[model samples]
Target: MSYGILSKLKLAWTELDNDQKEQLGPYLTFTDYREIWAMGIFLLGATALLPLLIVTIIHYQLIQTSVNSEFILRTERLTSNTRRVVTFFLDERLDALRFTVNEIPYNDLTASDRLSEILSNLKLGFGGLTDLSVIDHKGTQLAYAGPFKLKGKDYSRQPWFIANQKKDSYVSPIFKGYRNVPHIIIAVKSVRSDGTWFILRATLEIKKLMQTLSSYKTGRYADLFLIDRSGVLQTPSEFYGDIYQKLPLETPKYSSRTQAVMTTDAQERHIIMGYAFISAKTTDTPFVLIVVKQKDGMMGVWRRMQANIKWFVGFCILTVIIVITIACTNIVNRLYHADKAKAETMALMEQSCQLAAIGQLSAGVAHEINNPLALISQTAGYIKDLFVIKEQYRNDEELIENIDSIMEAVDRCGRITSQLLGFSRKFDIKTQNVNLKETIFDVLVFHQKEAQYRNLNLSVDVPEDIPDIETDQGKLQQILMNLVNNAFQAIDDGCSLDIHATREGSDFVNIVISDNGCGMPEENLDKIFEPFFTTKARGEGTGLGLPITYGLVKKLNGSISVKSKENEGTTFIVTLPVRIQKEKDGNENSIGG
Candidate 1:
């Protein structure tokens, strides 16, 4: 039954022309098992990576936010300290001027000698008084002392002279006055007992003010300077431009207390700046005190920490990928083996059912055909007997030949039916000594036509001295025939099939059937013997040939194994016991018996 189906499939595969083979090439190729493994690994890695990536990004953002907050707080503290020191210095100088004006009378301050003495006293005491001048209510200089030889110089048209006329005392912003140097003025308007008004003016040394401002300990990257309401730099900044240079930053609105803000300078450097407007009751002019620090310098420690965090995250990701790859590979490998075993077990069960059904069907088919076949044989024989009695007709060659042909055809039909019945019959532990050479030759005869049609070369190599084996002849024949037929199906024209048999030790015979044909991939090699698992296209096979052959070999107490490679061909080896052992009354029966 298996032979008939296998023969048909062999014929179909061998009959394919070159063009058909080309068209079917892709379909004939093995499935890409790597694609499955790759997909499994990718899914596993992505599952592990997505959450880690999101968490890492969130952590980085939180760290940056915290660092920025701390940076702003530190900058504000520095700016506040600088503003306090500068305000105190200006207020101290203003107090000195007011004290001198009230102590000396207007008559005494207007005398040149007396005024010079007072100037000397102020210069010694305060150390920043550059020059001194006395002016009356008419805006005329009444007395002058120190530097720039203008004892009678008039301050009537000057802004400071007019400003001091209205206010009792005033402190001017830093400016280049008649002396052509950056200096501030401290002026006091005084009234005598008779209600006569006089003004005392002094030019405050700018260098001393710069020293006082710089006395505050800002960090290395920070700069402290003074800017007037016009946004001009009043003091020389070590980092910013010189005195009187226009500051690049916008002047903030006047605030009694220090105000800190983040900004960028002209060079595009990030900076934190704080400003405060210095105001006093005696002074109408206000000056802005500014402290600036580069943001990068201030946040240097945080930047280092951020870099280290990045490296840590990178190492963690790398480690995770490697771990995921190893873990997923092991898991998928186990699953593949388990699934393959399950599939083979299922296929084996299905094959048993199919074989049982075929056995039943074969019996019914042989019974139904045998009756008509017998009637045809009997009728042909009766006609030959009648012709023999009629001598003249018997001598007629055509008549005799026709009857003989009918009998021969009927005999052929009977042989076919007998073989079918033999295949369907269940044997009960029957064993016989079978010649290895003769058995292989008989199986070859069935495939001779197929081999010739496909232009295949077939050969057998059995040593003449090899001993016969005790096995079921029918089962042995079926096993060899299935393997040869499978080889025929695997190959195209011009391929070869070689069958060889040899003795193994004293107990076993090894039969090898090898073909130079289109081989299978390693992944499917284990499944080739499984039932309903043919690599052939749909409708071309019933997938029962190898499984039935496997069962028959096992019934004879033999094992079969196959080796194959893509485009290289395949070989199947069957190992059977040289002497079959029979059981009788629960004891092993001797071979001689």
Candidate 2:
């Protein structure tokens, strides 16, 4: 968001190769870059999270299916086991009736007192027996015993009696018969040698049958009840309804083996229902053993596990986002600093090219001015010669003096042009042996007049022991000229300027230029050697003088430093090697772009 943060973002962009720029040109703004970052996150997130989501979905389905199957299987198993128990109980009661009809005589069964005694003994031995009855082939209730009293009751129209006539043995579903209480009956047919037949019937308590089914444990929110084929609940149900209530669930098709299925109940609770059909041997009405269990109870662990998986996936996404943001920030920061450095380097190269162009133009202008100055000096010298040779001009001292002054002015102009030529001629280093003291005087030539006019005291202190350095003559001269010029301009009338040169050990020389003038602030010292950095008033300085001077020193295997304090004085120190080492020189090809 801040300029300082994305400052070099554009700079780095500019450095891209041409081919890369053509392809990446769409990314031209900060917003575009940010969009790219967001898109990158999206792509990476999809690559990571898509798989996770797919796996979670697959895993969820598998777990649901497995739990569903397991619950259903359990329901069916419970129903089947309970059905066996109920069937076995019915078989025992039927066997007892069959045994009584075969062993007891028709006369004994027809007597109420005799049948009552048999019923009491049967209850004591087998249990759940409520009463006994005798019926001749004519379907008349000839006798009865125990509990309810009935004598000579005819039952030819009853469904159980009619069904019993066809089967040797029969068992009926639980129902309220003549006594109007829930009970079941078993009938056995007896055939005598005279081709006569009789039926021995026994009544069993329905409570004992219910107890047998209810005793088995089902699961939570589960119930075991009997339902007839007509969808009527024959026994009490916990959630469906009481006995004889029309159940909401459809009656299952009769199957000897157990069947399990998942369904929703009246309350919209999911339930797993398992059922087994019990076929009545005598009556057409059949009953089903039904087991109901809530599905929620069976899959509690799966629900908890699903919740945990969601949390884990959510956490993983958050971590990925955090990691992406941090990595992008770090990469962008590094790119910013690197591109900032490159941008600074490019500016320096541009400055060098500009300096070289100015140097070329100066050389052209100086050469053009030299021809006129040479002609003027030649004409002035000829006039002075004529004045001396001819008698009429020889006495005219004023004319002679004017001619001499004209030649002097021409010479001064020539010297100015020569300084320009010397500065412009250098595109590369040219080394020469030179006298240090004389070289300083040559630089001072253009400034000596100003020094005198300003009444400034100038001191040159060069030790004789200091040897002439082997280096580029033009570069060394320019270095001296710029420093001396700056020193002169910084001072006022009567200020003392000092140039002190000394030998630095055996290999180097030191040129110290000191001026007691208005020096710059301490902070400006570091930037003084940077191109276009200056403390001077706007138009007076291009700010390249000292920077150029510093660069020249570096090219000549030398170093430069400056010390300055505001309102005090400034000193420039230039250290040069006594001999230039060209074979080891590396600055020649490093000047500019």
Candidate 3:
């Protein structure tokens, strides 16, 4: 690829500037980056928090609706349940009244004292009952209970008496008696089971109805009462303290729907109401079963939910602050390092150009020296040959040794020239799929003599499954040779060379060269990959080895990481891909170890 295109591709794929990488140690891991990204999205979207918070709210409403429905249903059932129990109790009391009157037979119970005994028996039979009375069809009150003399009072004009004239049996809605004790009268109009009209009536105090409706505790705000078809209160209400008094009804027409929900205008309260249409199975009068549940009583659940939302919002704010602080810190640190690295890199590039010029000069000197050295070696060889022919002089050991010394100097000069040529030339990288393990082995073979001279135990452990990696074979060999030479140079005679090859995940092969050599401190580690940055003394070392290795690794689209502890050991991990995967089929492919 052209330099311009390559630069663009690098910029697209890389997250930070080259300068930053040299400055900051390294970016955070992939996992940490992902977490920060998710938190950012959440914080950004927090503006519409409440509408999307439906998951926390809908359940409460659903449960409240279910309970309200159930309470209304249960209350209706209670109405029927209460009526059945009360009816039976009233029936027994009425039967006793029948017995008392029937036993008198129009002659034996003419006395007022005897009549009072009958009334007392009726009162004792029923609880919470006040006065009792018997009313004839002529509307005359015949016999009665309590201190009021109700014997000759006519009630034919009353609705209860008028309603009985058309029906065989009936119960009146609540009304005021002559003495004004709140009461209702249940009358049995006997007609010989053939629809004839002879009626009997008994009055019950309104307090009894209150006692029945009061059985429910409908929260603190709820109140229960019975309303007649005329919108008159049949039982005493907590709000009004009235019986048989008209309430301001929302509707004038009687309804049979049996249930309703409405807001009372007088109190401005939302109420859930349940009503039952009266059946002949209970009473002749069309009474209603009414149950009330106040909406104000349900504020507890709402208040608690409000408190929970407060805590949730607070937690979100705290989380956002933490994430933003972390993000800003990381970004600032990266920028600082990048700027530092850029400055250092510009300086280093200048140094490299100067060094390259010096290398060119050295190569020219080596070439000039090599030609003279070759001539000297040839002359020395000819002298040795001449001496071999002169037997007498050949026996002179001093002359033979001197000639050998001259040849040895020529040989040493030739080796030095070769080393200079190798270091100075710029060879084009020949890329191919080279087995990394095999390349390492080649380097080891070339350095076998030096390793032996140092009496070093060299070991190799390459993974059997390692893939053949794409790289310049010669460049890799040179890099490995430099590293191995450095390793040998670092160690004493008894120390060993440890080499291992393994796959690093799916996309890379890792070759680790570790040694228990005299390691450097952290101060030197930072400059270890810089050109000419050496830890060795003036005559012993050139600092180009690691920098060359680093450059070669980068050229192969790979990386090198090092870890070391002073006096303990040092490891150089070289990572390379198994194949040079081109971007194809609209996807990036990574192939490796």
Candidate 4:
């Protein structure tokens, strides 16, 4: 059952008009219209985006390179200025300590009263001095003043003490010592003539050192701080960390001159940093001064430019896709129409040629054969008449039957010749009120004998409610006869044929003829109405019956369609208008040979 349905659908698809067929042609194969459309879009997209991608990459690299160069220059400058300020501060304090040690006697330095006076004088001159202390060669604090009491405190185990002993002077990183405030110590070691050593140490305020570094005036997002060789923060940074905290940045290789680098921070912010090692002339301990700035902030103008370029490129790609789609669709549609028109023109020309050749052949046959058929019919009638008059011959039943059979054959041939003549002859439009049921009956009657001989079941159902339609009687009869004859020829023994007729609308009637037979395949069904196209073997059919029927129906202003499957059956439907309107000239009959 499913196979039957599929065959029907296949037949219907093939029966579609030329325009519809052309529209659906591309879909009937592996390479469909949608695939073609997709391929076109892909090509256009690639073409449009290739240049955009290249330009975007080049622009991005250029922006990054230019920004990096600018960031390095700016950060390096800030680093240099901050280093200078920090170096100056440390030098001043060390120089002050050296002077104090050289000018004061060793015994006086050890005296608490004299050390207090010296501390007062140092604080008055340098506001950052937090405290002052005097230590002997044994790393013991003999005298101390300001914020901490140390009449006799041992400092031998301290890193600063060991460093100060080895070096003439040393500057330590800021730390919370006994005073519990962040401060750095600057210690100067002095030797007497007898090689007796003493040290003068002063704690400088961390806030004052930071203020000097910040005064350099960097960018808005820039930060400056000092880190030890181990990457530990010595000074407080607004964005990095507190003093004595570890810095996130890696420690740079020791360098006296400033060096800059670009990197991303933990927050994924792009940054440029410059660092310089601040080396004191009198000490070995070195501090790194770092200046950091945000890369995006430094290249804000370039970022805006990149964004604009991206938007422009996106717009171009979209525009190209739309334009290419429209253009491709237009081109394909135009080609489809042109090809359809060409096919229709070719079909019409071929039909014209077929009709011309058939007409000439029909005329010749009718002229040459009609006379002999008439003569044979007349002679056979005369033979029957003579046999009836002669008693002896009339009594011979076998001879009488033979003469009657000859007369019948002669009449059949005459009818066939007349039909051929009528088919070839063209006539002006003629209309008469037609009894569709009676006409169908007449055509069916000719095929009834053959149907019975083959043991075929034939049925006809014309509704009583159907009204008579006005059409060309001869053409209508021919149409019905051809269709009925074809139906009878299609079936074998025990098959069924059905004829149905009804009024379709106020202006038209429909007749359907169906048969259970060895039906045609889909390919043959498509060409069933074309001139001289047939499934019958050579010599069995002229292949002109259906074409002539088709022409006659067209002359009466009607349409015909057929559906068939390979093994199921065949059905032909004829739709005719109730009436064909006469032309303005109103000639009842005209002749064309």
TM-score for all models, in order of appearance: 0.70, 0.64, 0.43, 0.60
> Model 3: what TM-score?
0.43
Q: Cα lDDT for residue 409, model 3? A: 68
Between 2 and 3, whose lDDT is larger? 2
The per-candidate count of clashes, in order, stands at 0, 0, 3, 0
TM-score top scorer: 1
- What lDDT would each prediction earn against the true structure? 0.76, 0.78, 0.64, 0.78
Prediction 2 global C-alpha lDDT: 0.78
Output the lDDT of residue 310, model 2: 85
Better of 1 and 4 by lDDT: 4
Q: How do these models rank on TM-score, best leading?
A: 1, 2, 4, 3
| Candidates 1 and 3, the one with greater lDDT | 1
Task: Report clash pairs, candidate 2.
Answer: none
Which parts of model 2 are misplaced by more than 4 Å? 1-40, 136-139, 161-171, 188-199, 280-285, 300-426, 429-593
Q: Using alpha carbons, what is the TM-score of model 2?
A: 0.64
lDDT of 3 at 464: 80
> Which digits, one per residue and each the tens of the lDDT, describe model 4 over residues 335-430?
445554665666655564566566667778887999988898898899899989988798899998999889877776666566567657867666
